[model samples]
Target: MTFLQALWHYPFLQIVMLAGLASAVASGVVGPLVVSRRLAFMAGGIAHSVLGGLGIAHWLGAPPLLGALLAAVASALLIAFASLRIRENEDMLIGALWAVGMAVGIIALAQAPGYSVNLMSYLLGSLLMATRDQVMLMLGLNALMLGLLWLSYRPLAATLFDPEFAALRGVPTGLLYACFLIVVALAVVVLVHTVGLVMVMALVTLPAATARLGTARLPAMMLAACGAALLAVSVGLATAYAGDLPAGATIVLCAALLYLAGLLIRHLMERRRRRSA
Candidate 1:
């Protein structure tokens, strides 16, 4: 059957599409800030560290997502607080936490007898495997995150671009920075189910980076990023269905290709402008 037929005949496919749309919107809105503030490495740390939570959650037979949320928030807060107080060797500190988190997760999961069978899905993700309930939960969480971001856009931008000036103006730059990391953590949690922890960084950064190639304005970048992300997700989903490929890998690959194409276009534009000048 055709891709459209499959989407129409399957409720799970609808859920996958909805989840992608929600992810695209969230990533588009927050991606520029992440890139602007140079938080990509930190975001990667938080994303991979979620494995620790999954390990414990699986051991206790608890919900993995809940465990991931708790662990991610805790990790983000710890890194945020420490980096604020201890400016020395902050990169080393983050790296340590990153390693520890991933090690703990791997040890826990490895110890679980006969658990390796399903581990691939969590590590790589399969959006189609999500139930209706899981999709609804993702949608709700995305809504809450987006609402918080929308309400604090200006102050957040101030902090992101100029923390010192923002603090001088009593914009609570420290608090805002921490809050932004928390939101990044939340986004990581959402993207985890979609793209898996290992590849989440690509999904979070690629579309936004591509958008940055065309515009310097934050609002325009966000809009373009959303459109770019939506295009990637839609094309990826269709390609995966047609090619019988893994959804997460396919989506990430598509986004990467799109980013490379955008980069080339931007380079060409720059060359033309220089020639004209």
Candidate 2:
């Protein structure tokens, strides 16, 4: 049977596809900001810090995604506030926050009972376990994020390029930063189920990085990033089904390979241009 037939036959596969598409769109949309702002390390910090939230939720028998969202948003806010105050060497502040957040999470998890069994699943994702409800939730969150971005596009662009100038123009840069943080936090929470915390940063970064090579404009870059992410997820799912590989690892590896391929293609094109010149 064809892939479409398989998808139609297996409701679970359909759920996976929907979740993957939602994740791809969210990652693509938020990723460029992270890359453009040199916030890759900051994003990593936020991802690790979310562990604390996860631990707390697990200990209380609540949803891990809720905990992660709370923790991540707090961390993002703290980082944004610190960046405003520090004025210099913000990376150091972000790194410190990252360590503190992860340490807290580890300690909390250690105190919680019977939490180790699914620890790896949270760290590395388990796509097979994703439910239809979760997929629907992810889609809703992605739509909300896209809407927020659409509403704040101009200020966001200004803030990303020059926060001081944006503020001079009465753009409320701090509030905008906070809003972006919230969106990132939500995206991370939605993605935790399918991408996992350990590998989440890659899914958010690689597609944007690969897409950056194809375009200079923000809208074009976002489009390329979304395309790259979709390609990675689709191909990764196919490979996992065909070869019976671990789904999360397969997806990440597929994205990494695509990034490498894009780099190679860019290099070849550059060489060809040089030869013609």
RMSD of model 1 against the true structure: 1.7
The numbered model that scores best in lDDT is: 1
Q: What TM-score would you give candidate 1 relative to the actual structure?
A: 0.94
Model 2, 1-277: lDDT tens digits are: 6666788899999899888899889889988888887777777778888888988887777776778878988888887777666564667876776677667777777777773646777788888778877787788888888998999998988988898989988998988887887778777776677778788889889999999989978999999999998999899888888888877788889999999999999999999999999
* Model 1 lDDT per residue over 1-277, tens place: 9888989999888989998887788788778888877788888888888889988888778878888888888888888788786754657767877898889988888887554737777778768687777777778778878887888889999998988899899998778878888888888888888888888888889999999998999999999999988888888899999999998889889999999999898889999999999
TM-score of each: 0.94, 0.92
TM-score leader: 1
Quantify all predictions' global Cα lDDT against the true fold: 0.85, 0.83
